[model samples]
Each structure stands twice: as structure tokens, then as C-alpha cells.
Target chain A: MSDAAGDPRVMLRCERLSVRRGRREVVHDVSAELRAGEIIALLGPNGAGKSTLLDALAGALPAAQGRIERRGRVAVALQSPDLARRTVLANVVLALAWWGVPRGNRAPRAREALRAIGAEHLAARPAATLSGGERRRVHLARAIAVRPDILLLDEPFAGLDAEVRASLLEDALSALRSATRATLVVVHDRAEAWALADRLLILIDGRLVATGPPRELLEQPPSLEVAHFLGFDGRLDDGLEVVLTRPAHVALDPAGPVHGRVTRAIPLEDGVRLELELEHGRLYTVAPLPAPGPGDDVRVRLEGGVRFPRFEASAPVPSTAP
Target chain B: MRLIWDELGKALPMIFHGNPQLLDVIWFTVQVAVVATAAATLIGLPIGLALALGRFRGRNLLRALANASLALPPVLVGVFLFILFSPAAPLGFLHLIWTRRVVFIAQTILALPFVVALSAAAIQALAPGLLAQARLLGAGRLQVSMLALREARIGVIAALIAALGTSLAEVAAVALLGGNIYGYDQTLASATLYEVGGGYYADAVAIGIVLIVLILILMCGLGVLQQQGNGIRMRFRSAA
Candidate 1:
């Protein structure tokens, strides 16, 4: 990925963009850039301004403050797309027709788009009769059919079972890989962002807190808040530093520094999830089946952790790490 | 009871035998109703669409006014237009009173509010964000409006049927405006009133039956249109 400084490939640029809903500002003044041929995943918790930000970027909502510049046509598949009461093929064809595609070429292009997403078999079905998963695929096909320079998808994997999500994810990735357009997808799961995005952006409470390559940001989250969002389920606070660690990074040992009493042992398909209470806070970890039960004390060693200076939990976090 | 049965027997033959006066009344009624309903639809749809989709000050006020007019009395409209087209009134120079054109104008006025209010309600019932989504997909302003109308077509068709029903069955306004001039402005509705007043029970029954049949035919056509537009259908199965 190219840096934001004077990159000619940048298809979208936002400088200090802030958006307001009614009386409250939901998206703070944040600057970001999307370059050509990169998939950027925007990760945030529920109501972290993810959808609102996408709407502002898509020009569905007006910017309360800041500047947005787009170099080419943009297409967005909203989280809950409204499908007209028509056949699936006609739905896609109408979109192309409204975009001024020639009458002779619309059906062929629509069919091709549906074929790319493995939805060609559903061409004759009424859009209203489609299943939830099928509706998502059709929405994606409509966006992909436009062949836009900038594409925005808001929670494409939302509300799907594990098996269907996996299948759809593969199809979505394959379709996205075929194009070199700049794409931004909003997601809540860290694993999904890592799998699909070349770079990840972390947003919390309407502020963009961190952004970098997925691997780089995964190893070092830069702050406690960002670490928690990245699935660091265990936290150990020494007198000098506050360390955040994922369940996979901590191991059981006799002489480990951190000691905790097991509060609950929840069984999982492959293992057990041990909920432990430490002196300062709670920690959770996965262990093999037949592991420690409730009321048992255990000691664990931290493999390495993202460390931060000691500060009160209530202290305001900066928008970005120093 | 015997007299009623005798009139009904005569009415059936009068309808089946193609009575010339009855045929003329039916044709005239259809012509005036079709013209009035078509004119009302062409004018009211855009106004209703604007009320549904446009955001501006005083829009609710206009909508409230339209809703209030849904119950406007046809006789009052007749009286109002009668004064306007009277020779001594301000619009008297047009000399439109006692003519089919006057009947058409009054019926259009009577039906306009129904079309506007019902069509607006239909468009407003669509799912939120449909318009914005279409715009994001590269639809221009006019295209987005057209899409909205198409999405709410079933409701619009119902609105049109309501307007046609109102125009076709109109009597008080047609009487007051057209003066029931034979071969000029006489309609089935006004002619029925004339026949009944003159003690011509069989002719009145025949005209009333034809009017009802005309309404049924038009409504059935529109109902079929509504059915074809529906993409979702409900099915009921017993657990036998």
C-alpha cells in the first residue's frame, strides 16, 4: 500500500471530515485516504460510527465539517439495501439502466455480474422471494456490476450463520480480487478484517484511534482501548506498566508472575474457556478439556504483551497513539 | 312486489335489446368519466409525489389540506361551480355552464383530492432509504422519482380506481353543471335521476344496472394490474 503523501493512486481523500446526525456529531474530524487496488477494512464496535461514516463517505449524508474529494464514480451496497419488487435480473438491470447503460448491453452486463458472484441461477427469481444470504449476494452483484472506481460495503457479512458466512466470504473475496478498484468494507470481527483487508482502521466512540497494515497493527495495537478492541482478552498490570495480552499469548506455568483464581469453566466444542479473576481485573483464556474448574487458583506467564504507561482507566484516550 | 318484478323484467330486455337512448347515456357517461379521471391522474400524481418525497416548509400543511378535502361533498362542489359558471358570475364569459365540459371540470375537481391523498400515502409507505439507495446506484433525480412511483404502483393504481369510481358515479355535480341535455351532456347518472323522477321505473333500473356494471369492469381491470405488480404472494396450506 502506498502512503497518503502525494500518492497519485489515491481514489478517495477525506480531510478533517466530521458528520452530524440531528444535534450530535457522530463522526469526528478524521482524515483518511483510499488508494487504488487496496481493500481497507474499517473495524469498530456497535455504534462506533462505522455505518455513519460510510454514509458520509458515500455522500448519502452531508458532512457537517471537512472536505471529501473523489476522483471517480462511487458505488455503495448499504447494510440494508432496498430491492425493488422485480426479478433478480431485472433488479440488476434497472440499476444499470438508471445509470444510463445502453438498453442492448444492460441484460448481458447484469447477467455477467450475477455470474461473477455465483448468483446467476437466481436470475429469474423474484427479488422479494430471495433468502437473506441470497439478498446479500444480489446486493453485492449490483455494486460490482457498476464497475466503479470506489466501492463501499457496509457490513456485508452481517447476520449470517457461520457456514454461510464462510461461503459468502470466499465468493466476496474472489469477486473483489478480480478488480483493482479501491474498496472499503465496514466490519466488526477482527478475524474478518485481517482476512480481507490489506490495512485495518480501528474506530472507537466516533474517533479513529488506530490504522496500519493488518499484521503490523495486530502485533502492536498502540493503546489499551485499541488492544481490547483487537481481542486482547487478558490484561496484567504490574506496578510499572499495564500489559495487554491475547488468550493465545499467555501460557500456564508454575513460576509465572500473574496468579488468578478460576471463577467459571465454560465448555467449548474443542476446549474449555476459563474465566479467571485477578487482583486488578478479570481475564479469560481457553484451555484443553478437563482443565481447571471453578475455585481453582492458577499462575500464568505472559509471552510478550503490548505495554502502556500506567494511567487511570477513566482517563481520556488520545485519537491516535504518539 | 308484482310491479317491482314487472319493472325488473322490462329492465332486462331494455338492457339486452340495445335501447338507443340507454346506449347513448352509457357512452356519454363513459366519455366524461374517462376524461375526468385521466385529467385528475395526470395533475394529481406529481403533486402527490412531491408531497411524499420533497422536504420543504408548509408541506405538511398542504398535505393536511388535501386529506381534509377527501371528504369534500360533491353537492357543495356542484353548487360552487354552478355559481362560478353562472352568467352573472366572474367566469360567466367562458360560457361553459350547461355543457359536458363543465361536468368534466367538476368531476375532475371532485376526484383530484382523492388521487393526491391516496397516491401520496402509497409513496410514503415504501421502505426508508429506498430513494437514497437508488441515488447512490447512479439514478438521477427524475429516475429516482420514477423508481419511487414504480415501487408504489399498487397503491397508485388503487388511488386511480378510487378517482374513477368517484367520477363514474357522480350525480349531483353532473346534474347541477350539465343540466341533463339529451344528446349533449346527459350521463347515465343524471339520466337515471331523470327517469326515476318521471316515474320511468324500468328505464331508471336499467341505467343504474349499467352504471354498476361499468364500475365493476373498470375496477376488475385495475385489480388485475395490481395483482400482476405484486412479486410476493401468500399461500395457505392445511396440515392434513
Candidate 2:
């Protein structure tokens, strides 16, 4: 494992790491390994310790218990990048200066990083005056300028528009793919993680519930919690179990098992999302149909169905035996 | 009102005059203020940054000590320093009494607490996200301090200006330790006090006007610098 191609080393490896904010232990015992040339996306809902885990990996918060083994430098782009009262180019140059880059060669390197992010034109502008998306790009460029062995990004694409988001995602992916370094990203949205991640880790209440390739986790989740988090509804029919994946995975058919009338059809950029009113309230399905108006009778078929054990409800039933 | 207007008229020319005596007093005041402000800043900025950034035991006590020092009377500070550096005191052998250096030292001590308190407040008032982001950028301790200072440059300048102004207008500390010796330790404030004691009310008021003008210019310069720091533009008309 240590001598593999494109693998510098295990950049950061945690063993039962825990972190506490104030008196509350936000991160429970968590352990994971981030390898080189891999873009790992941490997925969770709000208040699920995703940011806390990212902070631990970035070394901003110390682990209260357990050990974190890091082999090389870690550069982080925080959720809110601190823009100094200086020009954007100066911000990048300051990062280079912190890394001990000589004064003579710093400008070219800073300009190169800015160009990589398509922010070279805004170099002379004051950073405080730029848009939020532009500031995020400048911060990303500053982080990438260091060329750290591990890069941690916390919600780097949160406030960016779709185009800028795609561009930044592509730049990050290219950087992660080309370098012999590891990248860890924290995102609450499943669609984004599926789009950009090589491997995915789902964190729930400070615990690592599942970790695997993006497709594997999306197809057959470890549990109903994982399935629901991936925007799916898992049900049980006697001994047989079934999992309903995302709306985009279901297709329309003339004759199918699930039949319902389209209650609402929302047109998306790529496809049309139709809300089908089946026996279980409404089920959402996505298709590349040309604007299906509401109140249309539609039949849906699950392309790749998954089966799992029945879900166990935590609450108890009231006794009515007489 | 008439006296103020007459004094102002006299003071403007006196300040612009090519006399060495007047120039010397102005130069002495500026030198003392600059030295005091620099020394205070050098000692206070790090201590302030450390108090704001570092998490340790007795941190509140250290902060309280700094805050308490802000209320110290200049005369008391002069007396304490005078005692410490007088000819019979333990450090008296250095012979630092009755000199401009003593006045500078006294003023620096007098201004230290305000600088520390204000700088620390500025750092503490910065957004917490800023510090966290700085750490994430691989900034160690020194870089973190520099980043905080850069981010709070406006407030830091404000604190510096206040310290400089206070040091310039101070009399007891300089008068007590400096002996008000002409051409040696006499500042504008001390010169005004000396002229008033000698029944030269017109000269005293004239010196007072110069001091007021100097303070006004200093304050306006600070305001402009702060606006530039905050990226605010000044309004003006063009010849076109």
C-alpha cells in the first residue's frame, strides 16, 4: 500500500478521533484514512458534525481522544474565507510568503494560481469588494498555491452560482486527479457528492455509518437511514424488501407496477421532475420528457431496484389485545 | 474669543517661522510622541495579540491588569519612574533623570495600557471566522498575529492616533521628570505651562493654539488613513 503508484503516502489517518466545542462533544469517536489522489466527500445533514470533522482534519480543532497521524502539510479553504483589506493578488502572495517562497518568484506563482481559477483579471481589485463567489475562488487559489499534501475544503461551493460552482468543482477535481495528494470535501447535498466524489463517507450524529464508492452507496445503501439520506424510500413487502432510489433513476413505462397521476411536474434544466400521487402519498420521479403537464396519468418502473431488511421503528405500539 | 483669535493668528506664523527655538520645541514634541507611540505599540501589540489569541490560565487576570493600568495618572507614573531612576534609586546610576529620554519613557509607560487595551479589543472584536480561516490557511502563530493585525489595521491606527495624541498633550509626566529645561526637554505643552506660569498669557494661548492645530491635523490624517483602509473614497471635483 505504501509503494503504490500515484500514492505519496497516507496523508492523514485518524484513529478514534473526538472533538468537543465548549462543553458539548460535537464529534464522537471517529476514524478514517485519506489517501493520495482521491477526492473523498463527507456527506451528512445539518448539525451532523460534518464541519467539526473537517475542522479536525484541518487541525483547527484538537482531538480530545485518540490519535491523528498526518504525514505531510495540510492546507484548508474554510467555509468563510477571510479576505484581508488588500488586493486579491496580495492575498495570494501572502499565502505564498507564508510558505517561505522567495519574494522574486512569488508574483508569478500567485498569478498562475489565480489564472488556474479564472480569477486573474480580478487580481488588482480589492478582495473585500469582490462577490462571494469570487472571494471563494481567490481563497481556493491561495490554498492550491501552497501545494499541500492534503487539501481540506469546507463548503467551498456553497455560495457559488451554478457555472462558477461547476468550474471550481472541475478545477478542484483536476487538481486532485493530477497531484499525488489527497482532498477531503464536506458537503451536505447528496447530488453534489455524487457528482464530484471518487469515494463517499456518510457521517450521522458524529459516527461514520457508511463508506464506499459513490455508486455503491447510492445503489444499495447500508441502512434505511443511509437510503433516506440519499433521497430514497426503502419499504418492506412481507419477507422481500425494496428500495426506491432517486427520481432520476426511475423511468416511465406504459405498463408498470407503480401507477399514479402526475400531481406536479417541475421542469429542471436537464430533465422534468414529476410528483406521482401513488398509494403512499406522492413519489417523485425524474425523466427527460418534454414538459409533462400536471394531472397526466404516468406509470413508473424502477430500473435498478435494491432489496434490504425491514426497517425497525424506534417507537413502540400501544397494546390493544383483548 | 478675542484672545483666542489673536493667539491663533500669532501661533500660525510662529509655527511657520524659521526660528530654531520654536522649531526645536515642535520637533521635541513630535519626537517624544513618536517614540512613545512606537515603544508602546511594540510592547502592546504583541501582548495584545497574545492575550486575544492565546488560551491559557490567568488570561483574564492579565487582561484586567492591562485595563487597570489605563486609569493610571500621568503624574503618579512620573513620580514612580522618577523615584526608580533618581540619583539615589537602584537604577539611578544610569543617570537618566531630567532628560527628554526620561519624558519619553514616562509617556511610553503612560500610553502602554491604552494601546494594549484597545488593540486587544480590536483583535477580539474581529469575526471569529476570520481567525479560524487564518489557521486553516496554514498560518502559524506569527502569521496569525500578522493576519489579525492586517485585518484590524483600521482600529489599530485609531488606537495609535489616540495614544500619540494623549502622549503629545501630556504635561505632568514630562514636566515633573523633564524639569521643563529649555531646548532640552521642553515640549509644546510644557512650554505653554511655563509661559503661563511666567505671566506670558498671550504666549501661552499662542502655544495652545499650535498644539490644537497639530492635534487637528493628526486626527484628520488618521481619519483619511482609516477611510483608505476601509476602501472608502474621498469626494472631490475635477477640473474638466
Candidate 3:
């Protein structure tokens, strides 16, 4: 992995922490460190204990085992933007007021936070009246307004228009670039993590499968489990499955060794994106001009010299789920 | 209909004259309702919020008991409190027997279930993240409770209206516990009952009219509170 974290001022560190929900443990012996000025994306499948870990780190959930040390104030933008039953400005102001910011200093600072996220126009609107994207921005504004030393964002981009998601991603990236805080985000896919994260942590069944910079992890995933998670569905010449590290890895070649029937062909600025239905499932490939149209037989191939990396846990962990 | 009209014709003059006894009964009714509601709020809101948010072995059973208590007979609660407050009973030290205080206890007991049940439901309907957000923002336990209550103001207001309605209109509890003594424990509801039992039709009708009017006024005030308290709920509905 690309160094558990590049620069280590370990703002928040969890050493062998296990979190329990009722009698069952969701995160078991998960240890990691989030350093200052680093953006780490946590990726996992459903019920993979990602949220359990986040909640434990936020100190909202109890850690049944081990210890977590948090050096600074934490700002959590929860999955659901639960604004108070108040005006938008009041929602942001309440967060500041609760954190001991002087009453007189709250509104202006809240407005500044909203202004920072370009959501100042929403300050007067009732928080309940906002749409999904507006709620996300208002929540982000509230969290960013605190200027917290640690930011824990759980699915902050879950429900938003594509363009809005892109813009929010850009804003988050820019904010991270300019700020000196540690951020841990939970996102859906590797592409999203690749865009906004300095490092990616892959968790599966309450165990850490891999950790590293997003691109490096994808290029040389530490485990076959993580390789499949990175969407490898393609087979190499030696008959082993591997992921196409980037869209640039795909190309249409008449002499290409790999073959599949084109199911869909859509045009883009660079080239046409072809969806090929393989034996196992669907495979998405990008083709330049002389691109195969729908119903055309195509020979597609991943760039040569892709190696499968293996990541093994210290001790075998028996996975469980409901 | 003719009986109502005849009663109104005879009672209108007494109402217009602003009979002191009738005014006293009305004032007593308001006092009992307000006191009972306030007491119930003090007793039930915390219990309700606790039941809704707490995780313990018997929490579900306690919540079920609170909800089922809403279906309890007011007269039965009155009887239970009556025995408890009786001179021979264990709780006889306070000597609240046959007084407004005894009636106050009964009314509060009657209202407690509605307050607890509705408050719990309201707190439960809250977006699950509210408490977490508050805590993460450096709010202490008390702050979390206060903020959660404020966020649940709309539901709590509805709970108050319901409890007040029951406390205001209930006669059996007050009649059994307060003994309906004139110029003392006699509330509008009990006074109306006493006038009817004594065949004083005009006085009963007059008290009934005052009761209805008072209910209308209280309902109007509750309506205003509901509208103001539910601004956030209304916005959410509109947005949806």
C-alpha cells in the first residue's frame, strides 16, 4: 500500500479497535491512522462495517476493544443531513454555538462557512425546505464552518445530480488541498475515491483488505478480493482475471487477443464507450475511432504486463454478515 | 333540540349576569387543566424521551406499557389514586384526599399516558441523525436532550394539547377524587354533573355552555401553537 499514510502527523489513530452493535461486533480489530492534511476514502461492500468504523471513530459508537485517540475536534457530515427544525442559518449557527463559539460570533462565522461552500443563498431558507443536493451543501457548510481538525463524511454525495456530484467533488478536493485537516470519506466506487482521496482503504467483512493511494491500490491491488472489488472482470492472456487500471487501458484492436460481442456503444468526447456482455457479467470498454458499433464483434484487450498483487491478513478472519 | 333551546333560554341570563359561582367553577377547571398538564409534562416528557432513545432489556416492554396506558380508564385511575390517598392507605401522609390536590393527582395520572406515548412517538419520528449530529458538535448529554426536545416541539405541542384536552374534559376522575365540593374542588365538568344530578337544569346548561366556550378558546390557542410549532413540519411536507 502507498504508505498507510504519506505524511504522518497522525491526527486520529485507532489501534486494534473493535466496535459492537448490540452483542455482535461489526468492526473487529481494525487499526488505522488518519494524518493531518490527508484525504482517505474508505470503500467496502454493503454491511462491510465501514459505517461502524466511522461511527466508532466519531465517538458516537462505543469501541468494545482497543483504543482510539482523537487529537482534535471532529466534524461529521452524517449520511443523512439531519438539520434542526430551524432556519438554514440557525442550523449552521447551532453547530457553532454548541461548540462554544461565542453567540455574537456564530452567525457571521456560519455565513462565512456557507459562503465558503458557495451556499450563502441558502442561509435564509428553512432547512427542511431544501432538496437533496441543497441539504448536502447546507450540511457540508455546517461541517466546514466549524473548521474542524478532523472531518468524517459518510456518503456525502449519495443523492445528487451528476453535475452536482462532480462540482461537490471538485469543491471537496479543493478544500482538502487548501486545508490542513485530516478527512476520511466513504464513497461508492474506486473512480470517486481516485478523484478526491490521497489514499484508499478497502474493508471487507470488518477486516482491512488493502490500503494505499487510490491509483496505486487499483494498479496493484493487494488482494484478489480487492481486485474483484476494483471491478476486474477481465481475463488476461494467461487466463487470470485482472482489472483494467484505467479507461486508457482499453482499446479496440482488430488483432486484439480478447474477444466479446458489443452490447452498447455510446459516443463521448474522447471516443465511444462500448458495453460488452462477457460470460461472467458486463464489461465496459472504451474504443477510439474505427470503434465497433452495437452488434459488432470486437477484440478488446487490457494493456500488457498487468500483475495480480496479493494482500494477506495477519491472521485469517472468518467473515460474517446478516 | 327543544330541550337545548329551552335550557339555553333560561341559562343565557345567568351567563350574561356573570354568576360568580359559575366563573369560579370555570377558573377552577382552567387551573386543574393547566396544573395537570404541567405536572404531566414534567413527569412524562423525560420518561417518553428516555423510552424512545434508551437501549435496555425492558425498554420495549416499558414503551408498550406507556402506550397501553393511554387506553386506561380515567375513572379506574381515579379509583386507584383514591385508595392510595385515602386516610388508611400507605400514601395518606400528604392528606390530599377529597381536595383539589387529589383531583390534581388523578388528572395528572390520566394525562400522563397520552403525554408519554405521543412524546415518545414524536421523538422517534425525528431524523435519526439529529442526536448524533448534536453530540458530534460538542453538545453534552443535557444539550442533546434539550436540542432534541426543541426539534420535537411540534410533536410535544400536539402531546400537550391531547393531555390538556383529557385533563380539561374528564369528570369522573375529579368527581371521584375531589368529591365535587362547592367553592373548593368543584370544576366545570364536576359542577355540571352535580347540577344535572340535583335537577338544576338551567345551571347545568350554563356550565355546559361555558365548558364548550372554554374548549373552543383553548383549541384556538392550541391551533396557533400547532401552526407556529409545525413550521418545520409544514416545510418538510411541502418540499416532499
Model 3 interface DockQ:
0.46
Interface RMSD of predicted model 2: 7.4
Clashes of each: 0, 0, 1
Chain A TM-score across all models, in listed order: 0.91, 0.85, 0.82
Worst lDDT run of 10 residues, candidate 1 chain A, spans: A313-322
* Candidate 1 clash pair list: none
How far is A88's C-alpha from truth in model 3 (Å)?
A: 1.6
User: Could you tell me every candidate's TM-score relative to the true structure?
Assistant: 0.91, 0.82, 0.88
Selected candidate, larger DockQ, 2 vs 3: 3
Candidate 1 stretches greater than 4 Å from native: A1-6, A253-257, A312-322, B1-3, B231-240
Tell me model 3's lDDT, rounded to 2 decimals: 0.80
lDDT of 3 by residue, B1-240 (tens): 998899889999999999998888888899989999999999999898898877779999999999999999988888898898889999999899888788888888899999999999988888889788877878776677777677787888889999999988999988888898888898888899999999999999999899989988997898787887776333321110
Cα deviation of A195, candidate 2, in Å: 2.3
How do the residues A89-191 of candidate 3 rate in per-residue lDDT, one tens digit apiece?
8888988877878878889999988887778898989987888888888888888887888899898888778888888777767655535688999887666
Query: Whole-model lDDT, candidate 1?
Result: 0.84
Alpha-carbon shift of residue B24 in model 1 (angstroms):
0.8
lDDT of 3 at B227: 83
lDDT of 2 by residue, A1-322 (tens): 1222233566788878888877888888888888887789999988989998888777778888877777677888888876766789888887877766778887899998888877899999988789877888898888887778888888888877788788777766655453577888898667669777889989998888889999887766777677777786423232433344556556688888777788888888888888777664356777785756788888777665444444552221211111
Q: Alpha carbon lDDT of residue B40, candidate 1? A: 97
lDDT of 1 by residue, A1-322 (tens): 1123466788888889898988899999878888889899999999999999998888888899988888677888888867877779888888787667888988999999999888999999998889888988888888888888899999988888888778888888878763459999999878779878989888899989888998888687767788888887776665755666677776667798878899988999988888888897667888887789999999976675666667754232222211
